[model samples]
Target: MPYRHYLLGEDQKSLLDRLVSQFTLAEESHGSLALVYLDTFDWRLHQADLRLVEEDLCGKARIDLRHVDGTLLASGDFPAKVFAWDFPPGSLRQALEPLIEMRALLPVARLGGRRDLYAVLDRREKTVARIEFLAPQVRGNEDNRQALPPRLLVHSLKGFAPEARRLADFLEGPCGLTRSETGLFDESLAALGRRPGDYSSKINHGLTPALPAGQALRQVLRQLFTTLLANQPGVETALDSEFLHDFRVAVRRTRTALAQLKNVLPAREVEAFRKEFAWLGSITSPARDLDVYLLDFPRFQGFLPPEARADLIPFRHFLQRHQRTEYQRLVKHLQSSRFRALVCRWRDFLEQPGGLEETADGMKPIDQVADRRIWKIYRRVLREGQAIGPQSPPAELHELRKTCKKFRYLMEFFQSLYPAEDIGRLIKALKGLQDNLGAYQDLHVQVETLGRFSREMVAEGDTPAETLLALGRLVEGLDRRQAEVREEFSERFARFAREENQRLCRTLFKSSSPEQA
Candidate 1:
């Protein structure tokens, strides 16, 4: 454990000298160090109580991992270039891989400073504790450094708590130093006018129940725009599949917002955006589909006998080749001027005040709008679900799936208007049903895709029979799973359509007048 005490007075050197005398300390190495704090745009590392820093000391670069409180966790020589995958195989990589899976590590703040290291000596001349006074001479944006006040740190070595406690008491009583509530990295960030949790892509508009429908929707659109822009860099770099996933989700939500709150925005503009985003969504789908198959390749292989699993290598290569081709197409389109203009126009429209002149019911309280829409969609879901029998056509189920998606989006958009617990229960129930339907549809698609691959391989005339056999087995396994999921659909839908959930939905979403506009 490490204990930290901040220097409160101007006499930091005096305080250190006093400590050297009182603890019978000896001078240790003292030098200048340049450090850069790193995190994702969303601060994933900091949120997990981890801090990663790249340090340059004496012309050597190293990365250090520490807790928020300044206790060192691990450190290793910095790689020549750092990527999410560059960390050598070790505990540090193991810890970081999950926390920052697909996000890039960005430098949050940079600090260049000098330190005076002192060791508290035991009677036997062994080091018992250590003290370092970090003098931050320059901080913030590297191009324009801002000098900051120096501060002292006390590090307690293991098994020497009593001695460290005594030194802390002396410093607090006579030296006038107080414990710092802020960490060094946080202080540096503040100097640069940033905070740990400043940015997030999650939709949190802080909408109120009484906000006008048009204004509330504009706020939602603004947030979605921000989310879309935030993920664009990741998508362009192909850092991870989630960037594209998030980008596509934002597009879908934007389209959904336009349709659901159609009356609030100008109909022509809304329709135009919907069409554009539909195109955007269409272009992004191939890459995302390929990503899903690549991600699920392991699971697909697991369905095959161990001895035959290697036979799927050709399929893996086929998927990768297609994924690369589709990803390149996606990147080219995303980087195009057309895509840039669309985002700018969408952003400008959403940022406009009062959002187009309100249509009939556009000025209604958002809660009222939400109540009417939620009740209508919920009823539609019920009507459609009830129409599905054991022998219902797959087309009917697909239609129900789309309805559930609309219902889910509405609940999510207006969630702030309702009791969170009640809305949560309703969404949960809907999700269970959606999951079953989604699985059923996805299985069918996968089976069809496998069959197509098998046919293509046979036409190529250079493929092995084992690969085809493996694809057949994979399709059969998926079919079996689809059948099982189909069998469970009744139970899942029953849970979603239970009396308790229905009562909650009706009580929460029942409207005062017929849904209008």
Candidate 2:
């Protein structure tokens, strides 16, 4: 186990001398260094109990993955600028990839410090327990004088708990050292006036069901706008595809809220903002579509033979070029004054205190409105889904997917009003059906996209015959998989529309009033 203590006194030399005299310890190593603490904007690594630091040790940059308790988990040489894919294939990359995903590992804080290493010796002069003293100074702002106080860390070697305890007792009694509540990185963050978990994109407004429909909708929209603004930096920087993905999701959710909570806000303004957001969604789609294609390229390649897979390299290059072009266009639009004005206007609208008093459903209790809308959407889903057989045209399933999305958005928006278990079951069942529909539509789109790519390749005249053949094979594979997904749809929808699920949805979401019920 690792033990940590905060030294109380200001005199470092006297403290070191006293420690040396009190215990059978010898100075082993000492160094002054600068360290940079790293984490995603959302603190994904910290939330997972992982700490990542970059430091200049031995004249080279080294990255260390440490536990929250300051125990070193893994260490490796890292470039000055590094991304997730920059880490070599090993335990560190394997461990970090899932946690950080596409977010950039940004430097959260910098600490310039000196460390002294000491080893406790047994009677036989054999090293047993170890201690480290760290004195950290804030970097980049020398005049602030906001350095982290010195700290002492005790490392208890295996089978030497007694010695560790003795040392702890002596420090607590004579040395006047107390345990520290904060870690080094956290202390550094505090010195810089920052804190962990300061930002998150999750919708966590604790709205009550009895709130007025207009007021509740405004609260929801404001939270989503906050999420949207939070992600704007990431999207503008093109830090990762997820930024745009998240931004678009916020847009979709906002649009859904506006549409679902009809007559709650000013109808004319709502419709105008709806059109503006629709425009936003349209401009974002091309880049997001390309992102999906590039992300799925590996899986697409796996569908071809090894020999044919090599041929797809040209296709990958094509995607990269197109994605860059599309993303640039998207970034330009996102950074435009028009986009900024729209978002500002939308924020003003959502933040406005009251809604039109003459509007229908504007003053109704949110629970009542939610119940009626959810039931209506669920009934529409049943009607649409039941009309489609296994042999139904793909367009029919595509339309049903849209309907399912609307129903899903309603459930998600009003989830807090109903019993958690019942709402969860309903959403879970709907998701299964939606997944099948989604896969089928995606496969169809991929097939069509590949067809267009084939034409482009032919027109370019620089592509090899083998690559075209592989592309054709890839298209056929996608069509076959699309058919397979189509086949699975009937069964998935059956499970979703089963009597148990229908009864659950009705029991939970159906209004208490007999007329509405």
Candidate 3:
């Protein structure tokens, strides 16, 4: 059976009532339902065109996964679960785990109301279709409530397609009802002063070539600042690792912008903020490191023999204990006056208008500045990548990694200034190299981190001999993987530095003319 939902327009309920008088409508069921919509902080499910709802009807709770168009894909009893992993092994868990990943499912919106169900009958008194009228109120904080527009749902029975079509046509033609495009999720979100996909970690500000470099830098900085503030509460609450991850990324991007756009902002202010952001990033590092390890604990266990996997349990416990400790220190630092002052001062500086002319390039057209910076960095990446040899020290690769990050960030920040397809292609090309480098660094970091953790565990006298051996095995595996990744870097960099990409980069970013815009 197909599910259809419509919103009742002005006085349409009376029109629907008058039209339904021609048929025999039998009351099926009615109840008050408490509906709570859930999604990740970044709206991952919403981006996928799916919504997860936990509905309570007369004390019975069920979690449902549905399309944006009111089609139910899966449903199960709503157990006391906060994350995908907490759910028992089932279809709902399977559908959610891949989408939500490590993010916690927070209640995005809540609505409370009564719904009445009626079965539509033909002259023969045979059930043809069912109708549902939902009148829900947005349940908000502090006993605040807002009424939403009423909704009508017509559910087509399996063998009654014609009747269902006729009913829908009648509703559309005379009842003055319209299909709901935004659906309840969006409506409720609106009532709560939020919109779907309102938050994202990616840099996507639109910039024009004619804009002043100072103004352009401010726009990007403001967006990054908003992302930082938006994720702060989630970080303080330790809701999920992604919140911290996004927060850290935003901080890093801010630092990059400050460092790379030195001549676009006042040097003294830029240096001050860069140092503060660096401090911020440093304070948040321990918790994030532990988060990565904990999130990858299963994979770590998989590297060992089945019987030996149990030996890592103590290590898992060790990580958990330290994760809690680090989170506490992290939250304290985030809530401190210094962090607050940094945020306030940064916001004030970004919000200011037209005072950055003291710097060298602040008044230049953004296109000219962007072209020069991007071209310079692109050449630097090429030079650095080409300079690395089979005997190059690991430190060389690390330096190249940092340079690649700066290039990537600059490209992303100014992507809108170039042809979308051309710039997108270049970004895609760089990502391949970035992924290889990222993997190599991660493997290297994990090996060193594991050794440090093993030493810490021994000092604390909490880890057993088996756990130590397990940690040793994990370190060896990581070392091998890191070497393999390092071995692949040459080919990856070769592809990135290929002629086609190089040519495209030169054609797109190497020009400062108005034609580039």
Per residue, candidate 2 scores C-alpha lDDT tens digits across 194-313 of 788777765656668789888878888887888888888887777778788889988998888888776888888889888988888999998899889888888899999887898898
TM-score of each: 0.87, 0.91, 0.94
CA lDDT, candidate 3, residue 363:
92
Candidate 3 Cα lDDT to native = 0.87
lDDT of 3 by residue, 413-464 (tens): 9999999899899889999999998998888889988898899999999578
- Candidate 1 per-residue C-alpha lDDT over 66-125 given as tens digits, one digit per residue, 9 for 90 to 100: 887666777788642244667888766877778887666878888887877889888999
Candidate 3 clash pair list: none
Which one wins by lDDT: 2 or 3?
3
RMSD of each: 3.5, 2.9, 2.6
Please give the lDDT score for candidate 2: 0.82
Off by over 4 Å in 3: 1-20, 121-127, 157-159, 173-181, 513-517
